[model samples]
Target: MDQRWEDAVFLHWRIPVPAAAARMPPGVRPDVVDGSAWVGLVGFRMHRIRLGAAVPLPWLGSFPEINVRLYSREPDGTRGVVFLSLDAPRLAVVLGARAAGLPYVWSQCRAVGPGRSDPGVGYDVRRRGGRTTSAFAVRPDPTVRADDELSVELTARFGLHSRFAGRTVHVPVSHEAWTLHPATVTHVVDGLVAAAGIDVEGPPASVLYSSGVRTRIGRPRTVRGT
Candidate 1:
């Protein structure tokens, strides 16, 4: 069995509807040129949710706008879609994050495995520079459990030239009973960031770190038992 983890930090920000529309790259059209617009544009998908009750008349697909769906997560933890976005990736992450109240940027963490059947866990954090982002898996560590408590630490700095040092974000798993795949972790991390409402437009400038471990679980028996 094996485990894997990965972390990445990116710059992010929110722009007002008009400014955001003006900043839209070539061949891009915003659902609304005014008012509150939840924009999530990444490699995976772009979702633009309009904030109004007036529905468009039929035959307006090429007009570059669509009715936004209202989604919500209840206080009891039940989830439902209150609205919909044409952008699937944005729908999955940005709106989801808004409903969850999780921070959107600075860093992201993801953990997967035990196997395909296991539910993967992902997290995001906001931190100052100098914090280390980390992902790791260990075998025979019974102290870990799926859905274990996760946390983010924020440090303050003061100075004209104060720069951040990468912070470590910890992702803990229940058991190292399965292999960890880095790509899987990356996908989840990206989704979490998108959900946080970071407009990741244009090409992504990403740096990747890859690592893994292999261990022999057992050796063949030298002789038959009596």
Candidate 2:
């Protein structure tokens, strides 16, 4: 699959390892950073989704998405993301991803702004079947470099860890190094994180933004002996 993620906002919080671990699927464990595991709330617009290298599917190819996710690694040190829930506007996308054993939920979602300034973006998400919702505004610093150690660790993920057919699978994805910017959360009303079963008591530990990147997700490979 090929797609582009635009005007992304990343909100991260450092939580106890147990809080993060409790939500992971089998065959992977929470990846600790600075003695705690981090969970992220990411919102963006997914654009031009195509199968393999095929033409983008109309309507189905573009939408707004917000996900609650965490970092993980296989026993062999392969790092990836473990999504607790992905809330998207398209039911087709929700169903398609769920069929593959990913946690995708249909939602009412929108990404607005970049407003008069390139960095001020707004996001809103509300799950269809439940009351999970989120709204936030951010100001991104275009000059911040993404090469810093923490930034690299957070944004350079190479794959996703999913639970499929009673097995844990790893789906590889490739994208150019993100050009990230420092961001400040100007406003927020979130429940998506708590809905994912992780308790974030205070403010986010890290807030970052990106102009975004084009990406390709490859086939899945089993990581657990199913």
| Predicted model with the maximum TM-score | 2
For model 1, give the 10-residue run with minimal summed lDDT.
153-162
Model 2: colliding residue pairs: none
Question: Over the stretch 1-226, how does candidate 2's per-residue lDDT look in tens digits?
Answer: 8999998899988998988888777888999987779999999999988888887787686788999999998999998999999998888888989999988988899887887646588689877765778998798877766567787788789899998888999999999998888888989899998887888878887888888899999999999654
- Residue 137 lDDT in candidate 2: 79
TM-score of 1: 0.19
- Whole-model lDDT, model 1: 0.25
TM-score of each: 0.19, 0.95
lDDT at 110, model 1: 30
- The per-prediction CA RMSD against the true structure, in angstroms, equals 23.4, 1.5
The residue ranges of model 1 lying beyond 4 angstroms of the native Cα positions read 1-15, 33-35, 40-108, 111-122, 125-226
In model 2, what is the error at residue 183, expressed in angstroms?
Answer: 0.5
